[model samples]
Target chain A: MPTEGHTGRKIIYDEDGKPCRSCNTLLDFKFATGRITSRAALPERAGRESRTIPAQELIPGSKSYAKVEPPDVVELGNSSWNLLHSITATYPSKPSEQKKAEMKQFLTIFSHIYPCSWCARDFEKFIEQNAPKVDSREDLGRWMCEAHNAVNEKLGKEKFDCNFWAKRWKDGWDEN
Target chain B: MPTEGHTGRKIIYDEDGKPCRSCNTLLDFKFATGRITSRAALPERAGRESRTIPAQELIPGSKSYAKVEPPDVVELGNSSWNLLHSITATYPSKPSEQKKAEMKQFLTIFSHIYPCSWCARDFEKFIEQNAPKVDSREDLGRWMCEAHNAVNEKLGKEKFDCNFWAKRWKDGWDEN
Candidate 1:
C-alpha cells in the first residue's frame, strides 16, 4: 500500500511507509498532499452525474481549464489569503440596483447628519434593520422622518430647519 | 470659563477645565445622540483653523463639522476607540468614482478566484501595494491583468489551469 506525499518542493512516495521526510519517521499519508493528487486522479464514477463544477466552469463559453491564461502566481501565496479576507469582511450583501441607488442617495443626503463614522454606521444599521421589513414607501418615509426627528431632538434642532434656514438666508450656506 | 457638555440625559459644564474632552477622551461628544441643531452653529474658521475639528461640531453641512449616523449609539460609545484609531491613522483621501468602480470590479472578480476570506484579503493587499496608481481606465485594465496573473501562479498549475482560473484560452491546440 504505497502512498504519495509532498515534501515541501516535490511529490514523493515512500517504500517503508515513513512519515518524516529527513529521518523517515513513520508517515501519515492521511494528511499528505500526495493524497490530494491520488484523490484527484481517481476514476470518474460511471454515468453523467450532475457535477458541482467550479465557478469557472459554470461560466458559459469558458475554455478548457488548461488553456486559460494563469493569474500571476507570484502574489498568489499570501495575496490570495489577503484578498479573500478583505473581500468577505467588507463585502456588502448583494442588493438590488434600486436599493443600492437608494443607499447612495441617502448617503449623500444624510452625509452631514452623520459626520462621524459611528453615526454613519448607526444610520446604515438603522436602515438595514428597519427599511426592508417595512411594506411601503410611505412607511419607509415615516421611518426616515422619525429617525430624522429622533436625531434632531438629540441634537436640539428641528427637522428640515437647516434647509429652511438655508433657503431663507440664501447667502451664506456653504454648498457641500 | 465653564463649557457646557451634555452627559447622556443632562447637560453639564466643566468648571475645573481639566481637559475633560481631550482629543482621545471625547467619545461622549463623538457618539452623542443629539439632534443636528444647526450646521450654521459650526464656525467657518473651525475648518480653516484646525486639523481636527472639535468633536462637538462634526455635524453635516456645518461650517466645520460633518454628521455620521450609526445604527446603535451604545456600540458606537464602546467602540469609539477603534473607530477613532482608524480616523487618525489614515489621511482624508477620497477615492475617485473610477477607482471605486475598479475596486468593486476587482472585488467581484477576486471573490470567484479566492472564495476564502484569508486568500481574498492577501490578494487585495497585493493589489493595493503593487498595482500601479490607477488614474485612468487603461491603468485599471493593466492592474487587473497583473492581478489575474499573480493568482494563477500560486496553485502550481501552469498559470490558468486551476479551479479558480481567469484567462481566456484560444481554440487551436485544445480542439485538435
Candidate 2:
C-alpha cells in the first residue's frame, strides 16, 4: 500500500525536474514524485529556521552525532550470523533423507534470496563453487563455519575457529 | 566448537546440579542438554549494588542499565516483512512456469523454516488454510498483503491497504 504521511494531504512530484542536490545520480526517473518519504525515523523540521538532516549526515561520519542507536549494517549482519549459526547448531545430527534434501534446498535458495542483494549474489556464486554438505549436521556446521570465514577473509576480518562450534553454540563453554 | 568468554574462560555446567532455580521447567535432558545457555542477556544482579552493567542491561526495561539492544522480535519481524514485500514487488508480473513453481516452493519451505520457530509454526498453519496464489505478481502481492494482515490481526496491529502496492515499494508515492 502507498504509505501515508502524518498529514492527510497527498504527496506530490516536483514540477521543476531538478536533480536531488544531495544525491546526484542520474535522476532515476525522468518524471517522479518529489515527496521524499523516509524509512529512517529522523526528526521532522518544526520551525521556519529548522533544517532537515539527511539520514546519512546524522550517521557516524556526521561529527554531529556519533553514538547513534542500534540496528545498523554491522549489528544486523552480526545478528544474522548469530541466527544462522544457531540454526546450524540445532540441525539434526543424523537427518532423514527428506530432511537432508530440504536442508540442502533451503540453503541454496537462502543464498539466492537473502535481503542484502549484493551479499546474496556473492553467496550464491560461492555456493556454486562450494556446494553445501548436508550429509550430517557436523558436516553442515563445519562447512558453514568455513563459508563464514571465507566471507570474513574477503572482507579482511579475522577467521573463526570452526572447532569451537560445540562450545559456542551448543554445549556450554568448558570452564575447567 | 565451544564458545569462549571474554575472559578466555569457558562456561561450565554444574557437576551434580538440580534444575536451575531461574527456569523451573523439567530439564529436557532425555532429549536435551542441560547445557543451559540463555539468549535473554539479562544482567546477573540487576538492581543491587555499585554499578557494573552487562551490555544487555543498558537496554530499555532492563534493570541494571536498561540500554542493551539488538534487533528484537519487532524489529526483526518488520525487517523480514520489508524484505518479503520487496521480493514480491520485484517478482515477474508474467512469470515462466518454472519461476512460478520455484516461487511457490520457496514460500512453502520459508514458512516451515523461518528463524522464529513460533512464528514459523503459526505461518505454516495459516498457509495451509490459505494456499498461496502465484499466477502473477499482482496475485502474489495481494496474497502477501492478506497474509500479513492475518498476522497483524492476530497481533492487534492495523491492517495495510493492498491497493497501493506499486506506490509504496516500487514506484515511490504518486503525489499527483
Please give, for residues A1-39, the per-residue lDDT of candidate 1 as tens digits: 334333342223333343222111112232342333433
Q: Per-residue CA lDDT of candidate 2, range B1-176, in tens?
A: 23232224332222234211111111221112324354223243233335677765343333443332223234446556665665676567888887788777878877765645566778888889998888888998888888898988887665656675544443333232
Root-mean-square deviation per candidate: 26.7, 22.2
Expressed as tens digits, the lDDT of each residue in A70-122 for candidate 2 is: 23223335555655665565567888888788877877766754544455677
Model 1, which residues run further than 4 Å from truth? A1-176, B1-115, B160-176
Off by over 4 Å in 2: A1-83, A114-118, A160-176, B1-76, B164-168, B171-176
lDDT of 2: 0.53
Say which candidate scores most in DockQ.
1
State each candidate's clash count.
Answer: 65, 19
Best by TM-score: 2
